[model samples]
Target: MRVQLKHPARLALALAFGFITASAAAAQEPTPEPQPAPAPAPEPAPAPEEPAPQDPAPEKCEVVIDAAGVPINAEPVTVKASFSRDIGQPARAQVASESGVRVLSAEPDAETPLTFTLTLDTSAGNAGDWAIALEGEGGACEGTISVLPASAPPSR
Candidate 1:
């Protein structure tokens, strides 16, 4: 059938009819089947963050020396050294100073004050100080010793 819009009244009627027809067709188009709300799109999972690295524990040790006098002028002084904990066996042991000196020997003991013998540098003059540093698996520790020239003879 042919539809024609001739008069104003007919044109209005034709426009209304076309609009209603389009709406009816859209409404009848299967009602969209009542979809299940699309399951909320499954909310994408969050990405995992990388973990941070850790540092190793610090080691600890101690060193000490004992002598007849603060200023070790004598030939030999009993040296003692220890660690924060047991170091299994002796670690690197040495006696050092700005003045030349030497360690006779190191004797290890189960406890602190591991005794040793230190011989002063024959060439070292009076009034020089040196540090005794002991290092091992545990770590390191330092102590100080002084060298002094023999006292002057009795005053007149």
Candidate 2:
């Protein structure tokens, strides 16, 4: 035997069916994800720093004066400067008086790689200790001169 619902039972069944339909529709729709707080707008980065300028490299060469002959007023003396190593080619020499000594002339050795001689002298008024410097092909040498006054006795 089939049992049919009366008026109150039919109304209760309709209310239950409507509630289930609403729940199913709500579940089918996409739920909005909790939006992450907009990443606080990024602060501007600082500009990159410029590097400092560098200094020029210093000159480097190891050379020496072989002999700076004794100095006598009004008398020319020969001074020789020799480089520690062969420069692989002929070199031009530049001579300058470091002190008050006079450099009469400079000449490079014909057969040597880096060797030269200087003719140096001091006038009677310039007699005393003086300094001379020679530069050639990236090398430099300095020497002292002990000039004797005209009145001084000759050295043995």
> RMSD per prediction, one decimal?
10.5, 11.7
Model 2 clash pairs?
A: none
Off by over 4 Å in 2: 1-59, 85-99, 125-130, 136-156
TM-score of each model, in listed order: 0.44, 0.40
Taking the tens digit of each residue's C-alpha lDDT, what string does model 1 give over 30-80?
755565655556777898976765765655445555553334344554445
lDDT score, residue 125, model 2?
34
Worst 10 residues of 1 by lDDT: 116-125
Model 2's TM-score against the true structure: 0.40
Worst 10 contiguous positions by lDDT, candidate 2: 87-96
The prediction achieving the highest lDDT against the true structure is 2
lDDT of each: 0.56, 0.60
